[model samples]
Target: MKATLLSGIPLLIMTAIGIALIAQGKSADGRSTLAVGVIIAAVAGSSVIYQIGGWDLRRQSLAHFAIMLVTVLPALLLSGWFPLDSISGYFVVIAAFLAAGLVLWISFYLIFTKVVPRKADSSDAVRMP
Candidate 1:
């Protein structure tokens, strides 16, 4: 879809810039930039996905958020953000992260729908004989 493609361009560009900054040893700045970029991309871009993916904005947002979380979770865990010596501890940390992600996805999806709104379709036009 055009929306999906358009949404991705900014993400790719900003993420690439963030990665470049990280590579140049600006870790803290780069990390935050990357996060901000992701948030912006996910929040703004989700409207496109929401429209094209039908009215299932929650599902689409969750799917996208899950993909991003999968990419980032291992890094966070390995960096000691969530200690994982015991099995139960692992489950706890994972659950906490999942819960957080769910909250974020839902909040963003709701905000995107509210802020962006749906384009009025011609199909909605009143017709008379």
Candidate 2:
């Protein structure tokens, strides 16, 4: 669907940028970790607009907040506040990023499903007799 394609563009762009950043060694983690966050956040943010319609600013704002929370989870987890394992180095970093991304995706999906409206179509319109 056109809507689906449109929604996906930002996510794809984010993924490309994340990849570029990782390749340039600007991102904290390598390709996999940064990529997951960028792609997930993009898709999640876009999905809010896709489902709820961009006219509603509140929905869009919530989506942005959701994306932020999702992106931040991994960083929070890896701040050395909690010792989950004896593992260290790249493995720990990657795992933390992936875990955070997954959590964000799940939480956003749940919250958005409740708040975002269903896609509008011709059926929703009333005829002006």
Best model number under TM-score: 1
Candidate 2 lDDT over residue span 1-129, tens digit each? 554565466557766766787788766544455455454555544554535644565666566546555654454454444455755654666666568656875786677688787566899887898
Query: Model 1 reaches what TM-score against the true structure?
Result: 0.47
Least accurate stretch of 10 residues (summed lDDT) in model 1?
72-81
Q: Write the per-residue lDDT of candidate 1 for residues 74-112, one digit (tens) a residue.
A: 544544445578898788767876897779767866786
Candidate 2 lDDT score at position 18: 66
Q: Relative to the true structure, how large is the alpha-carbon lDDT of every model?
A: 0.66, 0.58
lDDT value, residue 13 of candidate 2: 71
Error of 2 at 49 (Å): 12
